[model samples]
Target: MRRLTKIAAVTAVMALAVTGCAKKDTQTSSASGSSDKGGLCASGGSGPKIGLAYDIGGRGDKSFNDLAAAGTKKASEDLDATCKESEAAPDEPDSAKEERLRTLADAGYDPIIAVGFVYTPMVTTVAKEYPKLKFAIVDGAAEGDNVTNLAFSPEQGSFLVGVAAGLKTKTNKVGFVGGVKGPIIDPFAAGYQAGVKAVNPKATVEMKWLSDQADQKAFANPPGGKTAATALYDNGADIVFHASGLSGNGVFEAAAAEDKLAIGVDSDQYLTAPKDQQSHILTSALKRVDVAVYDFAKAFKDGTTKAGFDVYDLKRDGVGYATSGGQIDDIKDQIDSYKEKIVSGEIKVPNTL
Candidate 1:
């Protein structure tokens, strides 16, 4: 794969400074509690109050929650909404989660977004308490008249990544590392397996599910991911696709150290990984949580947003790959070709194990 030229050191610093300034501005605006802006969500006299609750991993993982935060920040900036967020500490109690929801509802937030599947039950229960308030949950479904569930077809994006891995692997051997063995990550593994089989009928894919859900420590343990990746590579699997959240960081590290390639999930992790490790990152399978949040916020602002399930797939450009860092250029043409096949019904990506 062709590596994009690195920005000059001074330019990189300047860029970081500018980003820091912008984040500071966003934090200041959010902190000020003003509601006059009209970008994504509307406020009633005090601006729209948008509340977000994160899963156990919290923010700064450079993955799912961070992507969702980008959307919330955009909504805050465009809609002049006051955004409030809370992180569920690792292993938070059910009562605490409920209390957090009630606190946000009591504070008058119109649409409270629960960031992951873990928040489904809490969101469903809270929506019943605040019947007039709207709620959005990503990666999970919540049952209520006021709740809107947003889910991404990662199976679709993963299928494309599977195609890339299938064509690019010289060894004809690939691997998958999942955070947990559950409904959320299973589609990624299943679709990847299908994609690999599509291109290379005889290619063997080594599958590893990091979490059995028997031990609660699976998804957050990077050392475990590193050990798993090392084992996969030792078994002759050269390219690995990981949906392990923070644990996926260890997969990248192992790949970089071993001089192999790895695929990322949720965000454009090529930018998040160390520079020396950039070459090992082939591409990322992106689920547009940011776009979903932004669109729904816009709907709420316009009074046209509906309640119920909203599913985003490749056909809608809601789930796809990232082009940033120019990391995907080497295979760009191939990626486009596969995308067309998928969109035209020539290809079907499986959604289950």
Candidate 2:
């Protein structure tokens, strides 16, 4: 819920980084965590060296990339590790990411983390070349002896937020704005719609994808997010939920302007959103990328690291809904009841429509 410190994803230009090489534009950061409320993140000792590559939005997107940054901070605290990072440009090709990964690897950073699924190819290819080094990809898959996949059941969290939206909607009309439509994003839309329909069968869910395929720009375009959410609000949706990365910032803007409510994704956006937009955020679907990232680092440090998929589901507390701004206080118990049912197998939350 704390306001984030990472810079916002406002431009397409970023600096390149390597451990031994000179940094351009100073985009690289010595991995650090968001402020620890009680100063709990004080460095304990020297630990592992980390290399992080962010998604297009990078850190400061106040959503996905920031959460990944939080994970590095956590790792820095718990493991007292040193970290270096590089970001992706707005429309840069995959080659750019591969080069970044190569530089991090070349710099001798162990257990390097790639912050998005787009890095699957790079990680799969790069990990093969660096057999002695460790690699992990968030929301991606790759075959290698040193690669691990940090995946999450984000649909479960989306379902929880959808429940909030469904219970809170005044007009019985809700909308979902997806940054892109694909295997990773489809579940968000499906779980949201399912949650809405589950609570209010008569409710109508207006769904739209900013992009039709696996386009990275869809998640970066705040203007598109605003336009999509604005149109939905104009069509009578009183509440909207977005799974559109940084673009969701625009959704919050539209919601505040239209005097409507919105649900955020990845992080507890209510705490990080601008003061004006804070009141309008119903809640955010919590995807604990931070925990997963830290776990991967810990595994690597402890020498138990393995190459495979690590899935964080609702039962694992890896996914849930936020409760900031007290917008859904009265209905929290109702949402918890649904969560219990889901955990107990009483309610089957579909990952797809």
Candidate 3:
């Protein structure tokens, strides 16, 4: 459900001097001042001008990036704010993200929101240079007097979905597919395994990562997600949960092809999935990035944005499991009970394996 990523190997990706958006017109700002109806900030926002930097795979991933975009939409309506956006290129180095931030700042965007931990260092370094422009990073540990770090308790939510799989699996075998192998993604696996074991101590969890440190496109490869999930299903897992970003698409595909159930991450994927595949999605572990982004936008507008962590935990309703498809309706009480225990400190879900 999140990326509390350890330091990304930015130095590993050779720096590219290319400074434009992964978008067609990287420098173009879609302001509400313009009459473009499809513009991101079209809600008649009259507040701060925001610069949003999306992680790789951009807005249509139906996972992480899409969730952040939703927050932007809500901000435009509620805070009367406007925003310009830039997207990270697959496997691009930190230099590109830095340029994206600088471009936004140069064009007068304030309180920039960088969507993932891959941009953490760049935000930390760039915020120092801008001094006055505020920044909020989702899942990043970046720090500065003007930067707000918005982190979510994905592990807590993962545990609840794990309960669903444990309760629903006919084969007593489940699967977990993470986008990458790192601290950021480990919590998901940890929480899921814990939850599964909590309900069925002997159940097996087939764990796989689409990419390791050697590969940076971990979050972008849908084919890899499909392959990994297919193997898990072939190996006897009746339900699969994927915390891989865009790659989770393939996981859904695999679920549909195999006629099995799957759990989605970061957003209510059941709402975003293809019609034929919707029924295959049992639930999604919600990271609520939109909620965090809206909270940040509101705080920034009111001059109350916190400098340190803005945690979205179970207690804060920041992270939880979604029940949109009515698939989990029968088990809602069981799931909520676990959710309450975590919120009440009776259940200590692990954030690491």
Candidate 4:
């Protein structure tokens, strides 16, 4: 729950200024001023206008973006607020991101939320331009007094799920599929590797990345994910855990086809993937992005929005592993024991490999 005083360098991408207008207009909607959408206030009542700029694959990702949408959905219903959303392109430029933020700010939307780390530079530049508007960035840090950085300890959650994979792997061979190789995903690899080593020191963890960088369409590329996961499975990896965004769908598909186990990330993917694939999902590393987004939106509406750095970690219950399939039920007690140790400061999950 402690706020990060400084953001560790996750990547070396330079910040670029958007000199002209951003191309393309995203879809927008007014969630309030309609039928009683079930809120503290009646319908047709106006409230804060919220805007969300999502990363690649947006809502249907059934992963990170969808989880973020769950938060906005809750806000629109509970706070009776109007909401609008935008999606990022596969090879979106820095200016395009900046333009998206600027468009929302200029349209009088307060407390705009940028859903991924790629928006850090854009958030920094745009927050300065719209001094009065509040902005929040997930998975990365942004400067200025008007910006709130909503980050989570993803490694911590992935570590717990790694414990699950280690416990359940009959073949003693598992795999990790990363969306893109960088500091952003290093924690997942590091924590998962450590967790597997912790439980089964001899277990082999095959690591493969879909893309070398963020703009290579790795997170949104399902075919690439399937290929990577299939290779791992065919090579005798019985359980594969993925930190890719929409690309994880391919991992799940591969798992289902091969009758292998797969661990999900960001959301309870067992509930999001196709029904046939649900049985193959052993667990999911929960990032609770919905909670962060919802909490920030509520705080902004209540006039309690704090602009600065904030982090949600294990101690705050912001990250953990999900057992939606009950596949880990036999080891539930053991997993909780590890969770307790993490929360009690007995275990330090590494953030890099």
Which 10-residue window of candidate 3 scores lowest in summed lDDT? Answer: 9-18
lDDT of 2: 0.78
lDDT tens readout by residue for model 2, 184-207: 777788788888888999899999
lDDT of each: 0.73, 0.78, 0.79, 0.78
Clashing pairs in 1: 35-47, 39-78, 39-79, 40-78, 40-79, 43-47, 43-48
- Candidate 2 contains a number of clashing pairs equal to 1
User: Which residue segments of model 3 deviate by more than 4 Å?
Assistant: 1-37, 214-216
What is candidate 1's CA lDDT for residue 63? 79
lDDT of 3 by residue, 136-249 (tens): 988888879998888877889899999999999899999999888776787788888889888888799989988775234588888999999999999999999998888899
**Model 2, residue 4: what's the lDDT?**
10
- Model 4, which residues run further than 4 Å from truth? 1-45
**Structural similarity to truth (TM-score) of each candidate:** 0.86, 0.87, 0.89, 0.88
RMSD of 3: 6.9
